[model samples]
Target chain A: MVFSRYNSSHSTAPSAPELPPESYHQPQQQQYQSYYGQPSSIYGQSGGFPAGTQPDVVRAFQMVDRDRSGFIDEHELQQALSSGYQRFNLRTIRLLMFLFKNPYDSLRIGPAEFASLWSCLGHWRAIFERFDRDRSGKIDSMELRDALYSLGYAVPPSVFQVLISKYDNGTGKAGLDFDSFVECGMIVKGLTDKFKEKDKEYRGSATLSYDSFLCMVIPFLVSYD
Target chain B: MVFSRYNSSHSTAPSAPELPPESYHQPQQQQYQSYYGQPSSIYGQSGGFPAGTQPDVVRAFQMVDRDRSGFIDEHELQQALSSGYQRFNLRTIRLLMFLFKNPYDSLRIGPAEFASLWSCLGHWRAIFERFDRDRSGKIDSMELRDALYSLGYAVPPSVFQVLISKYDNGTGKAGLDFDSFVECGMIVKGLTDKFKEKDKEYRGSATLSYDSFLCMVIPFLVSYD
Candidate 1:
């Protein structure tokens, strides 16, 4: 209920520049905020990290810079942030930087390493190949609603109506596509879906056995719950 | 951190009550609220809850009545708002009266039930009994500080400075007593401790083991490491 009090002032239009920051969104200001979300302008000016960086740092920087771009742009950065390259708090980023500050040793995280970190943490979502099962480049309203239902929010039709009214702003239409939807999840949807998709993949069958769901979700929940 | 932003605003001294709605000292609010933090507020004029209502709704209503005051004051209302009861939503309060809808049954919450709900999710301070080791009315700084240090973020001294400055206005000092200290741990300390605490309580140990310490403290490093 207090959460709603804080959210009441959120964007009137879901497509508006930004939604309100919940307690979870507090991570944005960290300097290591590289490779996450569509950089909201204040990012990317770290000025090519200095030399003498650790190998992983050097490598992470290089790999993250796809297309041979001297610097990673918004897209690459966002994927990295969404991926497990940065899951914990800013301190972990600090620790990583402390360990690999040398530009030469910079760790340019690849998808596999990223997945490994999350996997160890029991986060299966880190392993999602890519979302947009329909290849729509973004998830739709019903798609997300179903996913949340699977997560146990009891999101009935009325809740959906409120959810859409709260989040939808597609040129007078109600409902979210990828960008808006991603924003609603505060870029964490990528993290969440990583597990959901992985859970599906691990079960090998379409449906999940309760044991497998517990297996996949429990550790992350236990650690962070 | 974004937390600084929220704290800067939320922790500011409750502004001088200028407008009527926000204009009252807490004690004044408490005296009026004691009787009303319950289901009976709906029957304020009649003075009793009608029998026969759904259990959850009845429970929600009772929880809101925090004090047994015959009438719930706005301040009493806010306390319930911050706590677990969902009924404190501003709109819900307005609608219940205007629509002549009494959806809940009994509105009395016994302390035991309230205690369980508070344990599940609580703010940084004021958990009862569990950590208030000496049963002193307030939390002490050392106990609370030690608890947070184990979790990670070295609690910025400034946060305590402000909290004490406000909460201990009369005492001219603010520090966590044990209860407040443990409350912070229960929230930020993570789930590793849940099992550790469970085992400790289950085994009935006065002294803690390193395994419990690892479970309680080291796992938290995953967040900060």
Candidate 2:
């Protein structure tokens, strides 16, 4: 019912790719292939969704692109996500935009880009729910630590301080809600991915020159702005 | 045979506390009580060794205090630990001293303090071995992450960089051997424990005024020197 509210009969929108009626029954691996081949290096690793999730992503994009413009900006993304998940604040939405920036247009993500972003968000949402074990709608530092551990990132407690200082919901509380958790997970994952790019041997150390290091890291730092 | 090398027929040393010959047969919990009530708050939380471990700690201390002075300095600690565990470097020994400083003497730890410190190291050693899954005698960044995670610290990948830069054994390679790993663990554990004291609600955060916060934190930063 929540999704139907955003449907404007734009199911016939041609800018969005057409889904074959029989595509759902095809081999599951082939359907997820469409979600890949995007320009998102930060998310490239987590590309490809579980089988049968493609249409739902496309439908979500269609619902948010209520004007049938074939594209949706941060506001539309927020509305689309709120309908499907919960409301995500503007700052987190902006950070998501910075991370999943649409290659064709900086201001909006099209069908393919939206699918990629949604898949990534779904991945993070699962992680967020798993670590929010207290069901408190947020995760404390210990939970955050465990969540990051499961992702193969062992951050120090000091990093917890930095994360809370940056991503806490400004409500004078200590934990992170879903939106902020996603934002935090993305930044850490992004930075680690960036680092791992240089650490190809996976020895956990890299030898990048000063300029090269700055160029690699500066974008993630300033992306939300 | 390795321990016999350090034995100097000083088991009768009078300065160290006398161990009742039959203490070993007592209930397991009672044997561990002597390891607690130390002045080292950082290690107090980890006080008490496993059952029947007290005699081993005392024997290790006696072996190192060859002069029968009832106290061991950094050199003696290095010798003592090397006898039981892998040889710990002087720097790590000094870090241990800083963390488990003797109440009556800054430069040395007597039998009681030594027991507390040993039990804490045993705790960390078990953690270190568990995460060093490859049994490589050292842990790369990923393993370090798991180690810290087990200890309730989820540091950022960036902190791993800091730790590697600081504790990477000066070998031009990344990864920390036992000594450096222990040093890293203690500093992180110490800082986290301090923070948790003020974060009484376990919310992963605490609010402190400028001076109080600095006083709480600066010591951990400068303690090595």
Candidate 3:
């Protein structure tokens, strides 16, 4: 009776064709539309992430904008240079000042104008090497002072401290060392080296080697009797 | 001997020592005497310039002070920068602003301060390298704009021309490239470098490298666009 009763509905059902072994896994083949879902990816991909080789510019900018204003400015720039970028030169500052004027209210430097700015500052490489005393890839406050003295100038601790303090990362540190300051400059200027070469004339022989020059100059610059 | 015939008495006396052999010429030593005349010239004669190695820091400052104003102000500094030097960073502005703030007409950034000050600006190498794209060791207006643009800011042509006009060396170039601009920066900072692995890190990498990142962030800052 049970079998007879079950046959009433069972006999009415239609039987479909069997799927292949591979088809079991391929059930959703039609549903597999596009690729997506990844973080920090590039443009052009099916995913929201960028597909093509978008420059890591976003990340790089983040690194440069030390103050987190979501933008970079002169002070931020000054701070970045003090922090360690040692290449954000003053020459560009001429243009920097020109792009906009009167700091407090105005702050948007346009791209069109910017796109037409100076491209590099190679002289600083030679300059840095001179002050980088120990050559530890940085110039500490002491080194800075010494380097300045080498250039025939003497600086007071008070004034020196004030300058370093402006760029201080609030480490309660008194002043900037060479490396940290250069790093700050780099971030501010967005620097890049285009070539590598020494001044053959100077390197070969000149009035004096840069090192010897520093030795001679720092003492002369010292204001202390 | 023939040209010296006019100075009959001195020429005939033969008091002058023989010149050194062609193989060994101490140009620096000789030039040293030229700037600060030697009391001695030969081994037996002791009238060559004092072999004092100390640099005349006071003289250096005076030279930079061109107008004999007893101090170097922004205008004087601008003149120097236009001459060729780019180490000065925002600190130069700060220094100028400091001098501007001084109530005394006798305000002067003394040598010590300069030593330390240039040391502070020495960190701006990154900014320089970015603008010195060709790596020829300086920057012009186009290069400056490019560097600024890389920092996410741009300088308008009107302003750029005006800025360059401030220090136009009769070049009529309308703008500065890297070398010229850096020289200007150096003059602003007071010309001050030498020691490190030669900032290879600051060189070229076009695709959103550090320089590009910096450019991207510069648009909104204390000054630059």
Candidate 4:
């Protein structure tokens, strides 16, 4: 909760991007429709984005690569998303970079990586729509909780408050846009899956030595190679 | 799963201790009976052992401290449990030491720490009994799964296999005695509770910035401080 409070306060300035939600359209919705029904395909067998979305992903990448350098650095990414009126906290950006599989350890996004990220975004959009029950273009705390339960996590109310406060814009309301919802879902899914591995026996519990617990959770907490 | 394979194979030698179940009796069953019915009081306001269980905890500590050294070192603990025919893997021992709140850097269990652990064991026994639906002294995989689910975890089958294999004695059956059951339950509860703090919205999920995720989970994982 403290973490969310810090994040919301730091990013809630009026300078927050005011992009229209429509700007985040799926680049090639019609082409990807067949695959949409099977939402799981987006995250291939290895849980990475599929290769089929490459062409449209390339086009979207070019749109963001304003300088045509064939690669988008962090600054360019921030600027491009802002130009489109979609502002995100630094943590979200960093996580996206990690999820995109930045190559060369250079902290830059190239065509291949961008395509992967683009495909993920499309999947996230589909997921967001499913959970946005009110269709208000944003998901409130209750919706977020339901979505996560659907994903197999049963979070406690106290912890849920911290989560909402972290993403809630300064309006004192707990609402998350498509991007925030996806990011939050990804984190919960990742950690839940990891924890479940130890709770083998589906017993909803697992005994771990302190060392083993550290070994399993550290990677989820920090991305340092 | 791999971890379990490693642990089981490494510990499967005929030399493994075979402690008897009765060795781990509730330290102060009569004195703590009033609290036992309540269950919550075992974990007093400070989250330590209730004062009522202290005398019995001291008695149990002395039983384990066979050498009259005023402390139970790791070897003595392993020997004591094994003599009782309940052998635990090294990881479990390390975790127990951590949970017992060893005062010195050295890995030893004194009366104060033993009292705290004894209190926790009583609570664990109650929980184990609640889940041991068959009234058997041991909990099988299915029973373990049900118990964990009750504790708010939805473990997958694959992960369950790993857990069973890790604690299952070589009798070709999956079973966990009171000690193993308690150890596993504690870790799951610890980690699950930590995750819930982040999922404060009761949304069944939460978004954790990598750093924030790390900050919350590390304390549960290790006791280096």
Candidate 5:
């Protein structure tokens, strides 16, 4: 069956298309430039962030920056992630840096950028809690699958397993903490948006070859390639 | 302000774009013929309907198609809507007919198409119940607004009012029952998907002109135009 093939391929090998790291870095550089040019333009503009949460976001960023350098570098980020929230692998950290609009590949996060990232992360945390119905601090694979579906992505089981494996600890239990949950949500949201682009005729769904699906989801996955 | 203009315009006049009924009827005819030509191809393929719910959908359609005509016309749909579920207006019924792939402009729904529609509605119902938090047999306008946000639509207040007024009972209270809730969900999902298409660059948001918003959501609105 198609799903079984997807499962076998996923289990045996990593799935995302192999791109040079520079290919990943270029667009993010441009995105950061634009974002820095108009930092406040991103959040609260789209009702994604709550009205007064700007202050909260700034405070959160200040607490993470600690050194008063007005920027949170990779080391600071690592400390923040490891101390209180979920622990993320290096690949996930790199993705977060890119997403948080690290300017000119500086690998550091400034206040405006950090505020935007913080607010978005807050939104994702709320979503995570909603789906983490048992208050277990982690969402099991089943909950994660349902969350994706509710967000309008109906991933195959193998694709789902790959998603779970990306975040699950080595303990053999398939679950995702808040950071993993946020990462997964962002990836799914991006991919689902892309799929909807191809489905413009609104024929009710979009069909993609498995290869295309991997291309869309691969960048967010921890790269073993 | 932009919101004030939207609200005043909506209050003073009907908001959906005007098109000849024939214009609305044409593409749906093609869609229905294509759907009927390949009936089962519609449901499970799209990831819209979950696996293993086909039997439940078939049973639901059978129960609704009381005459055993193997098809459900507007009257049968009306019976189904009014008896066990919530009531909907004529315009809403026409929209549902188009969505359900009514065959050859006959305005009658066949088993396969009905099953597909039923399953999608089941998904929407689960969403509705989750937000219907009070279990009061209706979702108030506030709940409806939050539901849309949770579903990733960041609609403005005026747009939300327009949405509420479409389904709210005449008691001056704004709330939606199951059928109305389903109709609203379908419209929002379609619009949000279209918006995401325009937001492909993922600059975090899509900006649609009022005209474009109307063009996308008009067909589903009760057309007093």
Candidate 6:
């Protein structure tokens, strides 16, 4: 499988800090298991790490905050995530920074935000593994759809086309590497979540006035700005 | 989920020939568990049955082949399937007949074809369950994509639009019930399998001359005629 090809290098990284397989140590596993898991509240409230996962999250932060700074920028966040998990693309790293931006520093994430981000990644990892059924370190269009479906969105084929084009590996191969996969998943997820806030009845459609719609979309548009 | 509304009646049916849960007793369960599971060859040779699953398949055939004419037409096939599984749409039943037409009767399937069809449905059922994560008795566009992914096809979102539109419930519910879901799945699986025959290396692209492409698609176009 393609996963073997990609995971082979990281399997032997000498200094990489390893967290236990998600099933092993996390007591609150079930609480935040889904892609739309409980972390939204946790994220909004700037809560600390879920009880059992703190040590691992803190250790990863300290490793990347090499200068003993209280926060890690995109480069450090990338290093921190890669050492503990798969390497994230710079675009995804920036997206994460934007989502989990520190209150005091717009360019970086602090411990609480970092912890929230890590917890969120754990959920995304679970989702990624579920859809990457071939263990190919990436998901093709079919896998992407399945991932989106599990999250309760019945997107059209056009959605897949746009996502594949956006997240393509650039090798002309139609697959999304881990970083791109998570980014795509989060995009679908984040948007669906936002839409659902308006679709309180779960009717699979929502009505948003112009300003209301812009408020929902502008965050994503300006995130990189 | 919506499944409760759709499945509750069938759950209480008096004559339903309940097959054991897929995990229960079938020895050959693992052999044919995938959407592209081993039944293709089993299907090609007009083989009798996969050894351990014979009884259930035979029983289903006998129950549907009520006249004992060693044959069951579309209506009978639909009845048999709905009893053993969920109700399949007539269009899907027609699609099945087109694919598994009896040697002596173009409008129906015989014992061997019926057995093959049953086995194939078992595999589709497993896939349906996996992607119907919400147990809504239907798969939305997202669920549809996940199902396709498991079968190794990464379709674009536009494919979802086409499929969701094609297989839609007509209730404006942007979802596919079991019958429509199976039809959609089979269409994708059958096409991929056919294409794979030409592209042995699985390069995610295939080259076919004009005649070859026509030969590949003409059957589906002309199947109903």
A-chain TM-score of every model: 0.28, 0.65, 0.26, 0.52, 0.53, 0.63
Q: Pull out the clashing pairs in model 5.
A: none
Looking at candidate 2, what is the lDDT of residue B39?
35
Q: How well docked is model 2, in DockQ terms?
A: 0.01
Deviating ranges (above 4 Å) for candidate 6? A1-225, B1-50, B66-69, B101-107, B168-173, B222-225
Runs with alpha carbons beyond 4 Å of true place in candidate 3 = A1-174, A177-180, A183-225, B1-225
Q: Could you tell me how far off, in angstroms, the CA of residue A107 lies in candidate 3 after the best superposition?
A: 16
Judge candidate 6 at residue B75 and give its lDDT. 85
Fnat of each candidate: 0.00, 0.00, 0.04, 0.01, 0.00, 0.00
Candidate 1 error regions (>4 Å): A1-140, A143-174, A177-180, A184-225, B1-145, B148-225
Index of the highest-DockQ prediction: 3
Candidate 2 collision pairs: A155-B154, A155-B155, A155-B156, A156-B155, A156-B156
Model 1's CAPRI class? Answer: incorrect
Which is superior by TM-score, 2 or 4?
A: 2
Predicted candidate 3 versus true structure: per-residue lDDT over B1-225, tens digit per residue: 321211122234222111122222244234323533332322122212224312443334445765443345555554444333443444344434342222222234433333333333333356657666678665665666554444322333543444354444435443444334433433222211111112123221112222222222221112211
Model 2 quality (TM-score): 0.37
lDDT of 4 by residue, B82-160 (tens): 5433566554665666445443423566544565555555555665788787788888878887766554444455555
Candidate 5 chain A lDDT trough over 10 residues, lowest sum? A1-10
Local error of candidate 6 at residue A22 (angstroms): 54
Put down candidate 2 lDDT per residue, B63-162, tens digits, no spaces.
7767655567888998888766877866567667756764444567665556667767777788888877889888887788677666555555554554
Model 4 DockQ class: incorrect
Cα lDDT tens digits, model 6, A1-225, are 211111122222111112232343243333233313343443332223445556667778878777554557888999898766878876577667755665334566666567767877776677778888889887777887766555443445544554554344323346766677666655554554455466555444444432243334434422211
Looking at model 5, residue A6 earns an lDDT score of: 20
**Given candidate 4, what's the lDDT at residue B111?**
49
In the range A92-189, model 5's lDDT, one tens digit per residue, is 56566645544453347655455455555555566678889989988888888766554444556545654554344323456777666666655544
Report the lDDT tens digits of candidate 3 across residue range A103-171. 221232211112122112222334556777567666656665554443322334553444344344324
TM-score of chain B of each: 0.27, 0.64, 0.30, 0.50, 0.54, 0.64
